[model samples]
Target chain A: MIELFSDLFSDYTLRTVAMGAALLGITAGSLGGFALLRRQSLLGDAISHAALPGIALAFLITGSKAPLVLMTGAALAGWLGAALISSVTNRTRIKYDSALGIMLSVFFGFGLVLLTYIQRNPDANQAGLESFLFGQAAALVERDVFVILGIGALVIFLMGLFWKEFKVLSFDPDFFQTLGFPVRALDHLLTGLFVIAIVIGLQTVGVVLMSAMIIAPGAAARQWTDRLGRMIMLSGCIGAVSGVGGALISSSIPGLPTGPTIVLIVSSIVVFSLLFAPNRGIVFRKYREWKSGKQLRVEAVLVDMYTLAAQHLSAEYPHSARVLDVMSSMSGPARRTLGLLKDLGLATQLDAKMWSLTPEGVRRAELIIQRQFGGEE
Target chain B: MEYAIDIRDLTVAYREKPVLWDIDLQVPPGVLLAIVGPNGAGKTTLIKSTLGLVKPAAGSVLIHGKPYADQRVNVAYVPQRGSVDWDFPTNVLDVVTMGLYGKLGWFKQPAKKEKVAALKALAQVGMEDFADRQISQLSGGQQQRVFLARALVQDARVYFMDEPFQGVDATTERAIVDLLRDLRKRGKTVCVVHHDLQTVPEYFDEVMLLNVRRIASGPVGEQFTEENLRATYGGRVAFVSALVSGKK
Candidate 1:
């Protein structure tokens, strides 16, 4: 572990790759909060896949695989794909999900065809371009890291500047329209930012799994808080951690890939949050239900004991364990409940077989009965 | 006299089918007007068009003798409770503060003064204690009240509320009605897309009975009658007439 830490700090390639992945993670995670809240998770998937044709076309046009040119091309193509999906759903009977699916396959398939055509050339540099499909984090250099940082900073700054407008947009676009906001313009701006964030990640995470980088951090953060501001901050943190951790682990091991490793780390965070976070987590909900169930069982036994005393017209009337169990009608441990009542001074055991209510128990039972039946005779 | 709101030849369509047609209306200042119609009667469409949320096929909407765009600062809208996702990650205070976003303009954050105003609006709705509480934790009635408080913070001269009483409890309904009356007393024009016909005469000074087209729009005592209700509701006249007579 110490050797791995030293290598992470000393190895220049690992440092550049790790920094690039972390920057991509922060921007993608922050933007993903908006997408997740808007119920547009699939749109992220579609946009990333749709970016491929642009990346390929950028290479075709420039013939030089510069990061800036390729990213610009990728951004344009992703934006066009998003616009097409919106227009198709808006103008025609096609639903959003179907439009997204259609765009994803067509754009990605076109990109693959273009990629194959490019591979036919005898250029050695073209060999690594296909890595944009699954990503090759190891190929990232200092220049690429600077590009990622610049784009990521711009995205995060835009998110903060338009925080209120975007919040209103996600919560209620109709009301946002009524407020004289340029709703359509704001929407396109947000989509452009989302596309930028995705485009920047294509080199580190690739198109196929970039959506997971976009969505998982936000989803995990959502489980931990009920405030958008906190959720966004936490998502950025989770994304950063996952990015650095995945980069380190993948570099340390020979066979593991960085992108999938990042996804795996983030997915594990999501799973842990889903099971253990307070309020909305599954484990917490189950514990609450179990506690309520136990309380109900105890109340049932108390009510049964009270009913027996009422029928006999005396608080000192003793009833057998069998009679109380039969009256309670629950398949619970009746004797254990009776012992709990005795411990609470609500009931007293006269002998091994019979039990009677204490005065405090009588009063408690009467209150419960009154509440259940609204004080009726 | 310049009316608070004037809509001329307003027509709105969804997917090539008109939802509201030839809707001409002029609401006077400081009057509480209720727009009553059955389900699918374009009640919501009327409000949306007046606020420029929906693009009209052919029409114009003016507030205070000016186009809606020119008079946006003078108008505030409260959509139906069901229009927004209640489970969104926001506090009551933040949701209420959104009413001030237009006034704050672009790229400017809300400050201490804005927070104070939001808290004041919450107090008006008796929700000051729940300022920090997440919105989804609120009850349906509380949620409706919070929406009302948001509109209150806008401090606009004209307010449009769409079905403010739908799904709210009795206390919230009374609170909203009281708030409407209070707004009118302050010389503000308030128009509500109301569903309950029984309370129309009690809650509104004027009524507009609408289907796809306007049936009648005048003082409740003069224009709200069985014939116009029949024209608006089509087959629910019997049920509506019972409510009308029951009110009498």
Candidate 2:
């Protein structure tokens, strides 16, 4: 690990690839947060897919494989895809998802045809043009890293600038407009930023998996916090970690592509969050449900003992454990539930088959019964 | 005297279907008005068009004496609570602070002053203790109150509320009524898109009965009558008061 760390700093190509990938992660992760919250995850998919045709068209038109030139093309086409989706949904009765599907497939299909055309042409300059599909992150030069840095900074800056407006717009656009905001223009600005974020990632993560980078980081971060600012910041951190981790793992391996490796890392993060993150995690929620269910059963057993003791001559009289099984709703064995109550100091095990409510447990049972029946009045 | 809200020759349409037709209204300052009507009565559409949220096919809206754009800050709005996602990742205080976005304009963050104002507004709605609570954790009535608190921080002369009492508990309903009366007492005009016809006369001094077009609009005692209600709701309402009053 120490040797790898030193090599990461000393090796120029590995360093460039890591920086470029990290920049993509940070940009896509933060902006993807807005997309996720707005329930516009499909927009990212459509935009990235639409970027493919733009890349091929940019190469065909300019004949130069300059990163900036191609990225500009991708940005424009991606923006056009989002705009077309919005307009189609507005102008027709077709649902927004269907419009997104139409634009995404159409642009991507055209892009594939153009890519095939470029490959068939007898031009040696088109050597690495195919890498835009699955992104050759290993081939990212220092210039590409610099471009990602500059553009990523600007994207982050713009997201910070419009933080308040975009948040309100996502929450409630009608109210946003009523506040005298130009809702349409601001919405376009945010969407334009999404296009830029996608364009920046298209060269490194590639079109096929760029949308995953845009979506998964934010989704993973969402489970950890309840505030948007924290969610975005956490998402950026997750993005950076996944980017560096993917770069390291792919560099160590013989033939692993950085794009898919990074996607797998981010996917692992999402899966981990879904299963184990506090409060919102599936495992945590199930554990809480089980714990509460157990507590309820324990309390049920204690209360049944108290009720039976109330009917008898002496408060110290023990109730048979079988009586608890008859009165309680849950299917927990009476002895086990009584054992839990004893652990909680709510009941005393008088014998092998009988139990009695303790003073504290008696007080609690009366309070519960009072709340249950008296409150209804 | 200038009206607080003045609408003239207003028409709103979606495609070929007219939602509100060539309507005219003049609401004076310092009165709590209820725009009462059945579902699809264009009540929300009227408010949206007046606020420039939706385009009006024809006509003009004047806030105080000028157009809506010039006098934007003088207007406050509380959209339907159901219209927003309560599960959104924000705290009550943050949502309330969004009201100051109009005054702060573009690119400026909400400062300490904005937080103070938001907290004060929350106190006004009796939600000061829930400032840090996640919005998703809020009950329906608490969500409505938070929205009301947000509008309070807008500090506008005219407040437009869409269904403030819908789905709220009885205590919240009374509290909203009290807030409306307080706004009236402060010389602020409040217009609510109200659905509960039974509470119209008791809660509002001015009432507008609408169905596609204005059926009747004036003081509740004079305009909110059985005849106007039957005309507005089209005789299928089955209201007991209408039957009792009609017999009288």
Candidate 3:
């Protein structure tokens, strides 16, 4: 652990790779919140897959492997794939998802073919190009870090500038239209930013695991908060932590690759949030259910006591506590609740076997009945 | 004076059959109107087409003598509650602030003025106390009021509400009715796609009974008769059954 922290700061290669990975995480994670909210979580998957062809084709056409050139090529190809998906869905009876599947497979398959072609006609330059498939985070120098940083900043700025429009369009495009905003333009802008986010991550995270960077952080963050602003911020934080942690861990361990390691860390965060987040987490929800059930048990005992008192025409008429065991639907000893009720002064034990509601308890039980029958429900 | 809403020869279709067939309608200024019909009668389609949310195959929609696009500022719409995901991670005030997004347009953020307007609108719908509450925590009626509050923030001259009272509690129904009357009093035009025909005479001043075609439209006393209702709802028996069921 000490070595990892020490190396994270001093080792230049590790530092550069960490910065690049963190940039990819923040960009993809924040924008991925919108994509998730827009019900287009899988869009990242399709676009990232389609970017493989763009990366290969850029090298083929330009014969240059500059970060900017390759990234621009990848962004254009990713944008074209997204555009084609829309056109096919709009023009034909084909569904949006099916069109995505078609574009993803076709572009990726073509990219493989191009990659093989380049591989056969190999020069030393072509050797490192194949690393784009899985990504060589260790090979990411300071220059690559700058490129990712520049693109990530641009994407974040665009998101902030058009924050309201992007938010409204994601939530309700029809309502956004009624508000006199250009729905299509905002949509294209968001999708364009989405493509940029995918492209910037291609070198460090690679196309295969880039979609995970986009989706996992946002999804995990969603479990943490009920506000979009908070969700986006939290997602960015998770992504940063995952990126830095993944880079350090992958560096310290000899065989573990950085891209997949980052993916694993992000995925673990998602699993953790899914189980442990306070509001939406599975564990919290189960805890809430269990807590509510306990409350219901106490309420049932109180109400059952009230029913008996009412039947006897006296609030103080002590009845057999064993009768509550028969009256209550919840599977627990009715006597177990007396301690709680006694603490609240809502019930009193007249004897070892008998109990009755205090005046307050009777009032509370009546209110509960009224709520069940007549109130806001 | 120009009619608040003027739709002419509007037609919308899914596939073979048109949902709305050459429909022509108009609403005068300062009236509470209810668009009533049986299920599958293009009630929602009418509102969508008018708001330019849905494309009409053949027709034109006008707001205050201008095309809808030109007059969107003076128009507010509340779509069906079921149309959006309630579990969406937003507080009540944020959703209400969306109503003012029209004024902000693009690139500008909603500030103190917008927040105050949203809060006032929430008060109008009796949801002021719930302004900070998450949308997912709301009851069905509270959700309906939030949607109403959103529309109210628009503060438009013409309002289009598509079944705002669906699945709401009696309090919300009363609140919505009082709100519609208040809108009418202020000379703001309000049209609601309503399901409960029993409340037609008590709630709406003007009624538009529609099927695939325009059956009748006018004051409730004249156009809301059994004869027109029968034609709009496919004969007397179905209409009676629909009324007995209380919701269509």
Candidate 4:
């Protein structure tokens, strides 16, 4: 087992697979922050599916899997799709969501038909092309890793260079447009960058699952914090972990698709954060509300007892309390609550049966009653 | 002297359907102009066209005697509240700083001067205390105030606001209007897309009544007559007036 582990690490193919997925994951994670914030999570799905014709056209022309040709074609097609969505929405009455749905299906369908044709032709080495549909990260070559690294570096550099524009456009586009900031041009540029990230992801996560890579980590990071800078950084970290985890799990076993496995890993992180994070998580919010509600109810009961004791002006009374002296209704918990209040020193037991308010308890109860009467407002 | 903003025969369309037609208007400097109209009356589209956000099918707009594209640095815009996602995990300070992004250009971060400007803008809008709060936690009025602060940070000569008072509390509406008055006093030109007709004569010195066409434009004393109001609002006025009268 030790020898096998060493062999796996040293093997060029395995190393390539790990490196490629890691790079794609990091890039997707970085860009996903903006897409998620812009409410354009489906943009990745659109771009990834749109890259199909580009990949097929490249293969048809070159008769080989040349990374540059395929990537350039994919980027062009993706850019076209992004531009088409914008133009169609701007010029026509069709909503952006409907436009995207139309573009995604049409492009993917066309690509699939072309892919089938290529597979049936005389000259074909298209086995790897199908891997892009579900992603076989275990089969990544060194060239694939290089492609991922180069594209990832370009994306990171562009993000840093245009960080301010992206922030402005994403936050308040109207202000950017008024400033004559080339809003449409900058938008197209960013869309181009988004397509680059999605295309890079396509080779690792496949078309159907790329949305998970683009959204899951960002969504998870969002639940943990409310700062954009921190969320983006955390998203990148989460993406890196899942990328490595997916590669490890798939490589360890046969017939496990890497794309779906990676999605599962990222989704689990989201689920964990959603349930367990301290401030904004679902479980924590519900728990806090429950605990606070109990405290409020107890406070109400103590205030009721104090009001009754005030009416009597009695220094001593039996521990057992009656309800009619206080306003109207009473329940079982009210009685149990009075007993607990006496034990907590909020109330005093006198003559072995009745209940009276402590000096401190009387003041606290008076404040609560005043608040309930709208005195504070 | 050139007017603050001027449009000549400005006709704009979406696809082939005309949205704004034959609009000719001139706004002087230091004037608080309110553009009022019913829903889908091209209130937003007019602002967008002047800001160069949309291409006009015909005609032209000039700012400070030059086209908006040439004077881009001198203009600031505050969009409608609904245009942005409030749930975005950005703090008030972060959103305010976005104004400087356009002036600072690409690749450069806002400097000390820019930070001071942003904080000053936030202070002007009375949002300084909530500078670090997440945008989602803000009330509708506070959110509008934050966007105003963003426009303020631009330090531009011309400011255009789209439905700035929408969903704002009465106090917030008062505060934002006062801020606009302050801007006008400082020799800045402020144009707002206003929805409430009752506040028209009280809030704005100049008014532009629109209904996909240039119905009228001038000071409230001259152009805000019943004829223009009728043309702009159409039959909806009878129903709207009932609600308007019921308020007082």
Choose the strongest candidate by DockQ: 2
**Which stretches in model 1 have alpha-carbon errors above 4 Å?**
A320-345, A348-355, A358-360, A367-377
lDDT of 3 at B202: 86
Per-residue CA lDDT of candidate 1, range B1-248, in tens?
99998988999989889899899999999999999998899999999888888789999988999999998889999999999999899999999999999899998999999999999999988899999999989999999999999999999999999999998888888899889999999999999999888899889999999998999998888888888888888875677777777664
lDDT of 4 by residue, A1-377 (tens): 46545756897766777778788888888788888887888978888888888888888888778677777777888888888987889778999999999999999899899888887876647767777777777777788788889988999789878887887788767667776577778887877778898888776677778878889988899899888778887887788788877876787677787889999999999999999987989899999997786677668777666655666755233335555224425434565666667777877766545667787777777778878887756
Ranking by DockQ: 2, 1, 3, 4
lDDT of 3 by residue, B1-248 (tens): 79999999999987657999999999999999999998999999999999988888999988999999899999999989988888788999999999998887668888999999999999999999999999999999999999899999998999999999899989989999999999999999999999988998889999999988899999987788767887887754455645534532
For every prediction, compared with the true complex, DockQ reads: 0.82, 0.84, 0.78, 0.66
Alpha-carbon deviation at B218 in model 2, angstroms: 1.3
Of the two candidates 1 and 3, the one with more favorable TM-score, higher being better, is: 1
Backbone clashes counted, model 1: 0
- Segments of candidate 2 deviating more than 4 angstroms: A1-3, A251-254, A330-335, A348-353, A370-377, B240-248
Clashes per model (N, Cα, C within 3 A): 0, 0, 0, 7
Residue A371's lDDT within candidate 1 is: 88
Which residue pairs does candidate 4 place in steric collision? Answer: A317-A354, A318-A353, A318-A354, A318-A355, A319-A353, A319-A354, A320-A353
**Model 1 pairs whose backbones collide:** none
lDDT of 3: 0.88
lDDT of each residue in A1-377, candidate 1, tens digit only: 78867876899888887788889889999899899999887899999999898999999888879899999988998888999999999989999889999999999999999999999988887877888887778878999999999989999999999998999999999888878899999999998899998999998788898898889998999999999999998988888888878877876676566778888999999999999999989999999998888778777887888777777879668999888877776547688888988988989999999999889888888888788899565
Candidate 2: tens digits of C-alpha lDDT, residues B87-167? 789999999999999999999999999999999999989899999999999999999999999999999999999999989
